[model samples]
Target: MTMHNMKLKLTKVVAIVLLIVSHSVTANTGQPNILWLVIEDMSPLLPMYGDSTISTPNISQLANEGVVYNNAFSTSGVCAPSRAALATGLYPNSFGANNMRTSSNTAETGLPKYEAVPPVNTKMLSQLMREAGYYTTNNYKTDYQFKAPKTAWDENGIFAHWRNKPSNKPFFSIFNFTTTHESGLFEPYGIRKLEQRHYFSSDEKKIALLPNDHRIKTNEETTPVHIDKATRFPVPPYLPDTPTVQNDLWKVYNNLAETDKQIGAIVSALKNDGLLENTIIVFYSDHGGPMPRQKRLIYDSGLKVPLIIRFPKGYKAGTIDERLVSFVDFAPTTLAMAGISIPEYMHGHSFLDTSNERQYIYAAADRFDGFTDTIRAIRDNCYKYIRNYRPNEPYYLPVAYREKIPSMRELLRLQKDDALNKAQGQWFRKEKDDHELFNVCNDPHELSNLAYIENYKTKREEMGDALELWLADIKDDPLMKERQLIDKLWNGKTSQPTTEAPKIAVQNGKVTITSETKGAFISYRMKNDETSPHWQIYQKELPIKQGILEAIAHRPGYIESAPISLAIDAD
Candidate 1:
């Protein structure tokens, strides 16, 4: 036997002596099933939020049946960074995952493909659910600024569902609707790739159509159901109210109506399965709207989103929650609702836990697509303060991805001709204020800057000092260039290394495993005659059973080790 094998044997010998204490290990088995219906690139534009631009009866129904959160915000204005905070229950900047995205689509930008190196012992929220014996599924986007671990899900594809798990097992499933994504604002709306079209039948399509919409060109013969074109929308002061911009508004609301239909389908499925009463449903958007100055900025139009949580049997039905909540609170909140202990390493506190209700929520903006800028924001219930680290950089970065939208193109054309009105011309300013303070409660459009007002100087200084303290506490070095940050993540190496494989030893009726890599979290699955195959977070040595055992090891940001398996008999 090799030296590694010898070490494994010794570990196994020690484990068998303590095997009697392992049989009682189990998690909270009676927790209710959880469901998250996540939509992308949307704001609170429904009837519940006082926006009459569109009527979302399905979402409105959920709002009537659940608790609606009016002050929910994303840490970042963009999706990938917000998702990283949601997945790990930690601030993205705390672990170098704060950039818009770390890999893929970086060739033109000349940035290396690197993953955000979080702490070694960190595990994704799905893996935590799996360890607690809950069936987990995501249908499925894993843009967490790092590659997701193999042990994170039992099913992670378009067809992944709660029904795939064994009967009576509690489940945590996430369904992401791309119909409301920013890409919906691109031209040729009928040809734009939408998630709803993938599953809708021709009959369902006809039911979703609106009368006389601009999305359909003069060329197409077929018309599907969509939102009404005659509905007049209240345009924000930052954009023009021209025919072109109004057309984009129509498209946005039309896409939202389609998103509501998709949400209804998932709720219907739960009811059909007779699981509606036993499941806790959550509905929310990933971030804010998808327009110029909204999708990637630190303004409330970019970071604020709609959040609704319906407990089993509508425990808090028809109530509006006015407390401030951030994306960082999501992971710990999920764990708290499921009866799992929240880890101390998490930066967020559970609103359900009631120990640490927050008085403020913080947000930040960094590099986006091909351009880079650094801005941090702090918000109370009534006021918002923003500090620009690079004050000389223009507020508009000319991002290639955002310019694809029709309204953005219109703004650029109007700017070139000097035909834009005062409100429409705010975004094209040559320079930006270094510090900005706004009473968002009074100025919903955030048009007026109160930073330099003599009467508000004390308030401005207080918010600025609070922001500085937050940055120091989170250990975020926004001044560090992106390239240097990448080097730090990779430890000055050209590439990251994969985690070392674990060594497993099976002796007598117990199995013990250890990895050569320190701080690697070990997860294993054992097949018994009664239960389906599912990964479990290994706490102690596992007792041998009648079926098979498989194990893998991983650390955050490092590639997972190859799974090792063993067969055991009843003897």
Candidate 2:
């Protein structure tokens, strides 16, 4: 028979075998149930992604039987933005969630001055699915741009899920499992642990199976909701190969394996409940694994995630659809699958509709590294373009850096050394790249930069224009109205904003600053100070200080403002 028919038959056979072997995943084909199993701080480390060192049996099994996108990426590099894009099918900046974290739009936080839009609008993918007559539920997690409003789900909680439903109703449920979050408190090794241990040999019988950062404290371990305390994470390659690193990586493998085990159990339970056959099960991660630079960044290791969609009946499983997929596309894709109309506001196209799927998947990143302001990247099937708006800013900002990850500190030290080496220098260097481009086909790791080369100028400009157009379409006029910076109040470790221009206000001897548009940061520095750098926002009880408070508000695509002057009476 034809190759296409043969592939379809093979898929059917596998589905049949799974039904027989596991005695689960059986149902009618006409109205299939939809299930989303989402993991946190994970990249595609499964065997399907070619990482032999770790055991991701369930995910690998899913990939083997489902369509896996080789070039999937998040629209934004950071968490809130990435999630915002994923849920809304729009770019993060367009949704006014351009920063790493955000305050929910409440009262003054909403509309007019600040877009009335909640960090995560209640009217999103899940809501759309529900409106399509599907019962929607969340597995208790909305760690996205903002809180998941009540209207977003019919039911949700840490222990309970909506998939625990009656078979008669077509259901759509999202399960966010937080077992791979890399946390500093989980470090069993204390501050200088990696420095103390060189290597930890494999001992499968060990108590923890993986020692983890050995830095994880019990109190911190209890918080399963946050990315930091979720699970024992794997250490990445950019760090030292110390015992700490080895143990950390091993723990990540162990934890991932356990997560997979749990996933199998959940699927098995679903089948037992007779939800398998008619169910379309999807497995993926929010961004990437919590291994060093993998999370909250635009690197492949950060943006690329494991994805598997399984349909025993109509989906034609074991078929690989390689068209580019971005997280932003998930919302529209879900609606399309549910037979719902695509919203005009969606910036992403559903991949399920060959006519609509993305020809070029877009990805970008703004400030996320605690106190750094960086705007970089674009990607399609072949090339990637990155423009660092703030090239002179510190590349290794302390805020986003993970202390428990062995690779980060190692890279930091290497950056200090004058000596140079090959295949290194990718981590912790002060000198920032102003612009970068790479042919991903030739360089999957994205180790090389082609942005400056004369030959690639045309391609870069094309991508740059495309990015601009997409961004312009998504800007939230209401949200962009309040132009103030998003920064930690007391910490010197506040991230940089996008631009310098916004209407300014200085009042009550205290500079009561507001933005012409809501920006990521509002930094202040003395006008005549020798250091041109800004002081991150640090104010609580304020009666303006005697020093001149020179301020600026910034966000992606927006320019920085001239300092708004503020003066306080001498104490």
Candidate 3:
């Protein structure tokens, strides 16, 4: 061959080598998309958690291919406070969000309606993901004890999905399944027709029909039941072993089956888009079980939840992680998974970092509806310590909302007739002990209180001292009056404060926006109205364009500022 021909062949080989190297670099450095499947009012009751009474094939498959967390817990036993901790990476007690239903029933409590206010620099988890160039979405639930700022999500309704995001950007999407919620146990039980989406394919017709169907109520006779009524379920000692309690237990399992199907449908969509291999899938409940004592109590049945995480390429497949994880750790974990920096102000350290393993987890319980009580708990691998600030208050509070469940009514009936056994009557006691400690490893139901027992005195005192140190670290005043807490959150104001309008400046054919309100972030759209699609988070100056530029400012716990528009002329 000629010398010139040999030189051309070597040049072609070098070009091909460089091309392969460039592709590998891009694939390794790109962010992985995240999907969160958050279910409501559920515990670690599935077959994956050793409860084989009900089969959840979809969830079991996830566990087989991912890591199963044996010790995941929520910050609170209830939803609002737990969700607040998940969103902020801070404890609810640290921000005055420990109480349930802070934004409603003002007349019943004789206190003004208020929202929990976190530190000024804190941002919602989704908002932080957005600032890091991710398209964030939430499917319809934002009960974080404060109204979510407009800058939090790109799409935040029933129709929100990762499909609506730009093709080039990575996505962080959440889908909340309410099928297993506590309200589902109400009388005249029937599943909502909206859940029918789980049974059908994700075609255009199914998507279009969901929004127009206002008849959420359906016939109980026609609804599908996964568990038979005759199936005998293991009843807790605190609850009566009657048919009424068994039937409620049946409903719980059936609801979980339905939710599993819904989760399968969403996962199918991700696979169909060919993004499954590049995404991180997380499945967990907002809190725990929804029965009478389980919903609001700070026991293991209420605070412990099941967590499964499937990483890309099946990393750590079929492994079980026994580290103590809390709801406060969720925000930092997600940020870490996406290769973003975790904020220094966040109270939680990422579980992905093996060096940051926790020695203990904590939880709290406060007001439920109009009634109020103060309880705090701390747990290690084996023991749990709970302290009751209101020792004079009865253990049982008459919450009207919880009464809708048939099991709750059954408990009430047994108590009135004096037919409850000693074990079952523990919850109906007239008053509570000042301190309670339990060896959770042995008494899973927390049946025996070991605070006064001399055998466990050393362990009890050790846990008590740790709890006090935690309270001091967080600066939480759990004994403060509700009215006084509200005053502090609002800065002694009678009404909520509004964010100041954003100011826009134009110079050198570039535009910048700012707000006078401290910690307020701006959102803008170069289009028609506030209802327009995709209000972009203002992170940097943009080149001036010819259109109506609408913008608004917002800070969490404050009313959004009035929108302002700017008109730009053509050159």
Candidate 4:
């Protein structure tokens, strides 16, 4: 056989092994079963991507045994919008998910006035998958638009039954693992920086896993003492290589290893349960690894993610597809895998079609809440264009972000002192970068701004126009009814500079403040701050339905709110 044929055969061989492992049939007979093993805060440091020291054996093994995607990207940097875009397969420009906080119980306050509620007038992947005949379930750790596709899942991940896995048709089970979530434990940073702990050995790792040892330090003036800081990590190119930063990155590496172990358990469970076959598994994180500027910002570090798919025997494997695919394309792609027709409302096209042109990928970030900044970007094969809606805001705000890592505070101090070098200082000094562009091929770190570059002007404008056209066609004006309230409740602070208006909220549930102009105003049309203009706004009494309210308040404004189920009766 020719070399090309040999390569194809080898790929198919790998696919066959997984098929055998999952007990799946080769053909597309009964629609491919969907299984998404999503890991939290992980980057593509897998062995397949050439990272040898990462302790991700199970994941690494999967990479070697399946297909790897080097160009898969998420829609937003933060968890909620990223997962929201993935679920809806629409850009944040279309789906308005400002940021979701761990304790976002402002039901009485309102939604973001400028942000769109997710599952925004579109069919979800799971909903489409169900019509195509698949049982969908989520295990744990969901960071998407909270109530999008309200009834998409047949079961929650923390509660799915494999035995009920429906022998007749296929199954789409999603397990979003959060073992690598940023727990306030990495190394500290600051004037008196800490040193990296060389703990490669298993025993050393155990001993080094102490809270004080990994303290991430900040300034005595601005930093708090009560903050936890043990998982110090290595500072990125933008920051100085202080001891605390080194320790912080080291902890992140350890977290990656720990997350890998958890994934192995889930895979082993699938194998042990005799449901390995007949399932097509796709492994990816919602976005990049959980690092500063990596999680909630709009750079490639935050948007780009690693995707690996393992299919059982009848197809190909051990292949590499380097097409520029975004989370927007995920829904249709998934529906295609489930043998369903793509919906017209979705702006995304399926990447499953090998002939699909992967010319560009689009991503955007917004001041999702009162916590973050507003930014949007578009990327083609070689260039990326960014438009910061709020240029006066600081890159890092007083979200739970500052509360999570200790070193972060120290870095901020250096930023003020101008001690950070050129690269690291850019984010600090960038108090007014309204429009920027970067030649991604030359500047993968996205440190340089090509927006002002004379030669790339045409290219930048073209991409910008494309982004605008896409948004316009989708009726994504960033203001509908519920979306407007969410924006005010979230981004009301910064957007004020442009709108020059006073933002009002619904307090004590009585006043309906109408503005003389179009700005942030609250109108309690619905009792529950409902979005529908037609719905009546009447607060009769608290419902009898209730759940065990475990007053688990968060540090505020970082993560998506944890869903609280109203119990039938009060405790």
Candidate 5:
């Protein structure tokens, strides 16, 4: 026989032995299933958080049955950057993902469309879970500043769910609710028809296929009004108390209520699946509230979000955790809960182990759409320190997208008319101080800047030093130009790079796969059929296969390589 035919015969025998070993391994490893019920652009506005402006029964139930984290904060005020931190357990600034919406508005910025390239060895949190034998699913928002690698999750589409996973395998599923997003505050608001999917059964046939637009664009008359128009709203000092503002607040509460109902549906699904007791349900927002000043600023109003973690068998139920938790902590904490070892490279500490609880949290605000600004902040339990790199720049950035909200337009109109009060007009200041400090407990609105005060001098210096240390530790240059940053990320390349295709080698009756690209992750399938098959992350050399082995490679920020196939015929 030829050398190739003899090698194939030997590999076929090895494959048979390996297949038996793989099937003998237990499918269920007794790992806890993790379900993240993520919401968009919300704050602690529910009754559990001391703001009873809106009743959110579903979320309240979660709080009652879970530990409510009173001081959970996002690393960034906006969703994309904050999500990047959550996905990788690293601050967005650490990997140049701090800029909001890095993949869009290239023409306006006069820059190339770029993705945030994380450190070479950094793997997404979901990818780590998949490596630990979890069936990961995201249903399905992935605004992580970079396209997720194919090995990141088992399923990552709108229809993705724990129900789709193998019956015996544990799952790590994420369901994002966008009903409470910033666009919900737009005029002529109607409920997003797509959100009705949350109310539908998980059965694919029963789920309605809807348009991808999750924004409310129809007339207000077409939607059900959950909040009374006559209801009084507690307007913050930054926003004027006007009928227009009040109407927007009504929409906020109405949308929040809708979000609660959607949460109820998801919780019911978990219980119905007979996995409620075996699952750990975590509910949190991507960032903070969606209003103009709240959505993109680095203040408590923008960064602080509600976090509730319901452990299996009601572990620590109804307990309140006031530890300073940042978005970066999500990944490590989830890994700890899954009985998986947290990677050494992750910047976040697992909050589940309270031995090393953080005393402070850091946040950043960078470019939002076409506008660019650099602001960094650090907060402890009571005081918050804000450092504005461009003190000459006005706090009010005229972002066109934010202008869609009626309250934002109202602020501009009031500003033009010079009708705003001292407190309401603080946001429109032409210039800011180089540094500002606030006693958040005394002044929750952050209206009173105490940086120049005599009594708080010591506190100011301490916070400033802390902020500096954090920035240096993270290797973040807040003043770097976006274009220069892009070049650095691409290693001075004029165009984006693609991951090198993975190569397969057969030696000693073992199949080994590798990629030439540095830090590239390899994913492969062992099927001869030229159809879409589940891609498995290659962790080690596989027992020789006889039919076909297909593999691909991907590194964050670089384009994924095309799949290469190797066919080995049996004798």
Candidate 6:
């Protein structure tokens, strides 16, 4: 027999043994691999969602073989806070992660870097999967409004892929495409920041996605614009239907086509690895569109995202799920898919496991970059209620990052000249109503304010009451000063708290781990296991296994310590 054949058989045997250890592991099929295809700053603009502007063939293919979720909503209108909720299965507002971003290179906010301080023993979704022996990875976009725990993923970088893991181990991997990001609408048009936003230490990934590289078979930059400029695009009521606006819409569709090509490449990779039928593929966006009244506001245009989940062996294929799924539900749902127990601390319930359904999805908007505005929204299937705490503040805040877009510049110019009509001038209002209500089913654009409408008084009051009850339950204080919140998170200090390295003790034929830092989660990995490169959260005293053990300690907002290794003698 060939050496390669012998090695493959041994690897499969080990993988089967590992799966047997986890109680919730799939019986005959082995554990299903989970893959997340995340795109930035996009909304439901595909054929699956009733738009024919441009066809996303790859996304369409996934939809045909998967379930389409029409009512999926994000916790926030933007990425960072929404990501925080996604990572922890909790509301971003519940943990002080409601802001768009925790820290920025611009330093316009004049506040030090901070991390969303969740309650004790809170672990990220990926970290939870690692505990269940799944090889976890992220192709590097983690704008969670906090630094990810060191134990989050086995590999997290531009090159991280499922192929790099042990042949037999089931994996949970994430790949983020920035082709359709808000930055795509920037002055330079398709290449300025180029996928690396939040400007983390990703200099090594600077050359990851090359512009117009033909070597990659599905290189998005090399493709022609799928939708022509002459094509009449659907214009939202709030934005003017001018040449500049039409051009921006053209770019958005073209960018999505490029994003589809990238998605196709990833699907091809999974097929090449022979894991397509054994993995569950999820395609979704970070938030809604990047246009005005879409990216930063709490309207449905900003909060709703497109979601398609393709299950292994075509489970629930070609089905449309109208359940009100939220970003907070993502973590729990993924964990439940892996047969892991969802923690009670999680604010979201397992959509796949539980029979009960969510009646409403809540979204919030706090400070954005340097601008501070307080807005909260609650949406059911048909109605949406928005409460603006600062009624005197303009509906529009001149966010520096957004002003970089050409169409935004045109809108501002038109507003200054008073050339904008009533619909186009909605965002430029001097002040907004304290409370607003909209029947989103009838007015998807959320332009018709029904807060004072006598006919819809009952619906408006019910939504308002729901919003108030949600805020109190989550203990969300949008009125809190950013500086004060920062101080509270850091234990009255202006700087972030550091987590002390974990101390390990070997006793009674078992290993125990502890950390001095408050709220620091301790996890470890066996150095001798080639398939288990990721750290597993320490649940209880683990019996000494046949290998050397290595462990690392980390907390969000603090630097992780070097791994501490300990040699173990076989019993």
At residue 516, what lDDT does model 2 achieve? 57
Candidate 3 regions exceeding 4 Å error are 1-29, 191-202, 205-221, 529-532
lDDT of 5 by residue, 1-571 (tens): 7999757744544443333223222235657788899989998888888998878888999889889999999998899999999999999999989998888877779888889999988999999999988999888789899989889988887678787777777889998887788887775576444353464675542222245344445554556667777899888888988999998899889889988888898888777767787778899999989887899999998999999988766677899998899999999878877667677789887777555579899999989999899999999999999999999989999999899899999999999999999988989999999999999999998999999999999999999999999999999988899999999999999988899999988888788899999999998887865454678889998887578888889998898999999986543
**Following a full C-alpha superposition, what root-mean-square deviation does model 6 have from the true structure?**
8.5
Q: After superposition, how far is residue 436 of candidate 5 from its true place, in Å?
A: 0.8
Q: Rate the local accuracy (lDDT) of all candidates.
A: 0.79, 0.58, 0.84, 0.58, 0.85, 0.81
* Residue-pair clashes per candidate: 7, 51, 0, 63, 0, 0
Worst 10 residues of 3 by lDDT: 206-215
Total clashes in model 4, counting residue pairs 3 or more apart in sequence or in different chains: 63
- Compose the digit string of candidate 3's lDDT tens values, residues 132-228: 9888988868899998888899989767878787778888998888888898788767644333233335563222114313224545456667787
Tens digits of lDDT, candidate 2, 393-475: 65555653476466455555655773324435564556668777889788866778887789999998998787666656654
| Pairwise lDDT winner, candidates 4 and 5 | 5
State the lDDT at 248 in candidate 5: 88
Report the Cα lDDT for residue 269, model 5: 78
Residue 493 in model 4: shift from native, Å? 23
Which digits, one per residue and each the tens of the lDDT, describe model 6 over residues 383-415?
899999999999898887898888899999999
On the 0 to 100 scale, the lDDT of residue 552 in model 3 is 96
Each candidate structure's TM-score, on Cα atoms with residue i matched to residue i, is 0.88, 0.67, 0.92, 0.69, 0.92, 0.87
**Candidate 2 Cα lDDT to native:** 0.58
User: CA lDDT of 172 in candidate 3?
Assistant: 91
